[model samples]
Target: MAFIGASRGAAQGRSASALAARLGFRIGLVGLFSGTLLLAALLLFSLQPMFTKRVLPILGGTPAVWSVAMVVFQALLLAGYAYAHALTRWLQPRAALATHVLVLLAGVVFLPVGMAKGFGAPPAEGEALWLIGLFLASIGLPFFALSASAPLLQAWFARSGDARSADPYFLYRASNIGSFAALLAYPLLIEPLLGLDAQARLWSLGYAAMTCAVVACGLRLRNAAPVAAPVEAELTVEASPRRRLAWIGLSAVPSALLVAATAHISTDVAAIPLIWVVPLALYLVSFILAFRPAQPGPDRTGRLLSGLQIAGTGCAFAVVVFKQTPFLLDLGLTLGLLFVNALMAHRAVYALRPPAARLTEFYLCTSFGGMCGGIFAALVAPHLFSGVYEYPLLLAAALLCRPGVTAGGLPAVLREARRSAVPLIGAFLAALLALVARGPQLGIEVLMVCLVLTLAADWRSPARASLVGIAIGVACLALQAAVMAEGGNHRSFFGVHRVYTSPDGQFRLLVHGTTIHGAMRLRDDEGRASTGRPVPATYFAPGGPLSDVFEISRRVNGAIPAVSVVGLGAGSLACHARVGEAWTFYEIDPVVIRLAQDANTFHFLSECAPDARVVQGDARLTLSGRTEQARVLVVDAFSSDAIPIHLLTREALAIDFAHLDAQGLLAFHISNRDFSLSHVLARLAAERDLTLLQRLDPPRQPSVGFAHSPSEVVLMSRDPAVVREAKAMGWRAVTPDLSRRPWSDDYANALEAMRDRWRELLTSAR
Candidate 1:
């Protein structure tokens, strides 16, 4: 019975192989086509992380980068679509084949998977246009070829297909499956096991194989379609190019929305390693479900799921806006909303798809939409919307997509509904406003009661009335977000900079990414002291990492420490130096220095290291040109949520090491919400023959190093004896270079490494 069932299932499956053979399918051409498609997927997926990492300095690593990249990608996709479309005419099939092959080969003049030597250098803010041009020069061809795969191959397949019947739609889905698999596989397997060099080589080999395949496919097409007009298959729906573009926009928007959600929610908060892939995985899965032909179309599910999305969106925003929601619940709401939104939007796209004749055009359009969504959410949102309000904005967009989906908290057909004892909508609103305007347990408890009443009132239309209920339940969220945005929260290329204002108005705390960077009360903020005098608060507060620059120099160099801070966050560390101490600060954002030295925020120049020189550029590149030397250096250039992968590379560290006097100290502020970077330091130290110690020091005390948990500042040195000193002070020697090779400017990938460690991290949550 089991054998029979298996055989039966196999028989029912689409028999493309036998059908092709029967129809005299040019096996070589088909093979080449499939190979090329696979190659494109593999190359694109493998290089995504590497490429995304390279452009960070330009994009400035804000949530906006995701949006900008998305838009940029979508626009690229449209160009590719237009290119392929244009190529079908003027250029014969053989000519197209010859031209594309030559183009692919030409991209190699700038070979290997890594970025150029000086692509990410700062002060490019003024030269951003030129920077983009340079970046495009580097990435355009590879991206163009890879982007052209689906449509180009599909067109090739159609032109060489069976005389009586040719189906291209199914092949598009196959390509999609391949692309998605590669996307998941990158983080899940490839990135962890392979460095960027290896991955790039592997991709090149795949492209080579694809090139061979394209040769055979083109030969087959020339032989078969010789001066003959191809038959036009009957189409159920014929859409203009412009309509197709709309389809692309539709898909791109949702895709970008997904990216934004991932960036905002997990970028700085998820205490997991390289977990950015999860949301992207879901996004790809939507393609799997959406591209496949639905039985009655995905509309039924789309409509139902879309409603739930609205609810999820409303609740999520309400939680944030009202500021009364738990953090975990907030994340859960976001994830839920995202999952549902993808399903609904993707299924809607699947439903709108035409037959095989228009399939490539359809997919081209879908890809276009995905690009748009990505740009809006990833690039535009962070800059445009002061708060991380992407969820609400996406939800609002989704609601518009659904058309006539009511948000007034009243079901459209309210007259037919069963009557309750009373209407609490107005009462609910009144109570919420009163509670928000008031204070203490009395007000909060009363507000909670009102929240419950409003939820009950809207129970009839949970899907449509979610936003209203959210408004009531977490009405304080709006106030919190507004207050937080006005002054407390700031978004920049460096990530989410959140400064919380305490109810007492006596303290201000700076939270970057996921960790609390500084917590200084007015008393602490106002006065600074080391062995005496006022000091600015932050990581460089008199006794912190900055002070180590001076203290270590005295111990190692004897007189004073010439220190360099990669990121001069308010120049607070300058105050820690004693007289005759020389210090140079490398700051990427001039705006940060301007604000820090504003005198109103907190004066560090008058209070601390009075004559600090600020070098305005990327620390990595700037250090490359510096002739100065430091006894101690801190690579706290953990700019933005987007980790400057290059700075963490062996090349960057070696440069820092070069600038250091022998027997000097290199302190790396390994503060991150996701991934234990200690492993990374361990790897870097091993590669460069250095010793390392991980430390976490509480305020006004000697630093304590913990080997067990993640939050740490790594102290490394070429001198093993100095590391021994740190270990004697409770600093456990962290295991370095236990993973693979260290990442470098040329190429580096820790995705696969992070993936391997996933089970360990997820265990706690599980």
Candidate 2:
């Protein structure tokens, strides 16, 4: 009896071992699918900013470059999803796998990716189209291949006959997780650690590894039995027109919001990859959470996030309405709104998802919607509105997606309508009365509060939620109209620029993203428009370091014959052009040139230097074509508070040097609120064995026709006499730190620059 029992126990042990091995094999197969898709996603997303950065210099770092890049990416993504959908729908399982593998191998030919050759100079006109063509020629094929991986592999997994394959949508969450990781890592780790060339090589290696994993996943699928015909047929449910439209609408709002938020935030900050990554990272995180399986419990967490979304939208609206909000607060509120709205929109998409059989179709619709949104925001809105209307429009669209009252028949709808209408009508009347009795400020406040309350009360009803959102958006527009009535508000592909008289009517300022690009004193203490001449204000004030450049240059090198100024903000520096001096302005934006040259808006260029030739294009590109060398070249092409980094790179400097005389003084306006560019300039000076002299001009009292803001200028010259004269004029010798690396076209790091600035601030504070 004992012997028989032992034999039975041993048999049972073998049975358990066999089952364990089978389970492990299934898990490994699923892991291969998930892991390869994740890697593919990482490569796809990280390459976006990487390649865009490479192309930025070509176009002069216009914000539109990023916008156009987004449109291209979305279009490619749609193409990829469509390809996957077609391949799966037409081919047998083994044939589809074979075709996809061939595409992967073909993509390998485009390895060690960087910007393609022959796009050396951007055309003066039709820049957006040129950029699209450039991207298509360069990274298009590899990116399209990578974009197809998620949908194609998921479709393959669904046909593999494993239990996990029954619901392959979970792999999407894994894909976004990889995307989120890549975006975060690019700014924080990859960009800071590796140069663009090194990054490209590393990405190539990653792609090779992902190809191996894809082959493994394909092998596993091949070993498994082909999907039963009945099962495959069962998965082919046609989506109704309504459901497809819902998917597109749900996808469009978040996509538009992403572009708008990035544009809005980066306008106030630098338009570099570090700032660019934050919005995109939040966007990916939203996808990761929205697509993940719902937790087993009451969805209190989701409801809370929904509430936050509404609240954040309200806060963002308030910030826009009241333009005096602090920068940090404004940034936080806008980013918070983006995060919550994206979460809500993506969750809606996830909830409406079809079975694995329709997986590629769903992604195709989503990608199409995304492409449409990108085109509207990046292509249409700039031309459609004088301001950033898309931001508010997208905000309203996001609110419209909120879960709302969708129950009962006509009577039930009428009941819900009545419940919503009473409060809205009452609030509208109250706002009207407030406007008549008090003022626009009080009226707008009342309307905003009412909208917020209505949205909160009817949070579950889409109609009511949309009504509230539209109401708020209309109110905001009215406020903007009122503000623009003062005249001189202009919007372009770069950013918003406003020309407004100061409170005292003593100065007219050209403001861009809360930074004063140019200010002209309009009246004297006697309350009359100054009749003598227009004076250079802000950084170019008469006694500022910028003035010192001309003063010392004229003193040391004799009469200045030619000067080239990059960045033509209100053409304030044009006031510095002496008679007989052939001054040229290299301006990127035509709108800026128009605003600055208009005698009605600003008379600096007209009244001070009417003959100052304006070369309208990216300074780097335009300057490269110039044959005349300048005695002085002023680098002052900052877009609001953001640095045009392409203008400050080593390659750019080489171009500038080629356009300068032997003793030409290169004056860099390094007075930035967020970055210490002195170190960067110092390093560049050292590389050329040039003398670097810097001056932080002392602050002055605010007087009519004079700017009070202190300016920091760095002067680089190979002439010892020029440096000696600058030093005698209170310009201190700028010491280069051997530890700091000079920023090149292939290797600039905004994060490092920001960190150095922070360290300096800390040291100064101590």
By TM-score, the best candidate is 2
**Backbone clash total, candidate 2:** 6
Q: Which candidate is the best by lDDT?
A: 2
Q: lDDT tens string, model 1, 464-540? A: 34344434434444444545653456665445666564454444555555444443335432344223444445555
- Writing each residue's lDDT as its tens digit, candidate 2 over 1-766 gives 8899999999999999999978887898888887898899899989998999888877668667888899999999999999999998999877887888788888888778876778767666677888899999888888888899999999998888787787889999889988988998998898878889999999999988887888888888888857767557856588988788878987888888888888877776787888888998999898988897778988787678767877777777887777878888888888888888888888878888887889999999999999998898888888787777668778877876654421222354455566677788888788889978987777878888888888888766656666677677877877666766675668777778888888778888988877888988888777987876787787888888888899998998899999999989988888888899999999888788888888988889888898999988888889988898999999998887888898787888899999999878898997777888888888988899987889997566554343557888899988878878988889898789878778998888787778888998899899
Q: What TM value does model 1 have?
A: 0.78
The residue pairs found clashing in candidate 2 are 403-460, 404-460, 404-461, 404-462, 405-460, 405-461
Please give the lDDT score at residue 286 for candidate 2. Answer: 88
Indicate the residue-level lDDT of 154 in model 1: 80
| Off by more than 4 A, model 2 | 1-17, 118-120, 228-230, 405-417, 426-443, 453-465, 698-706
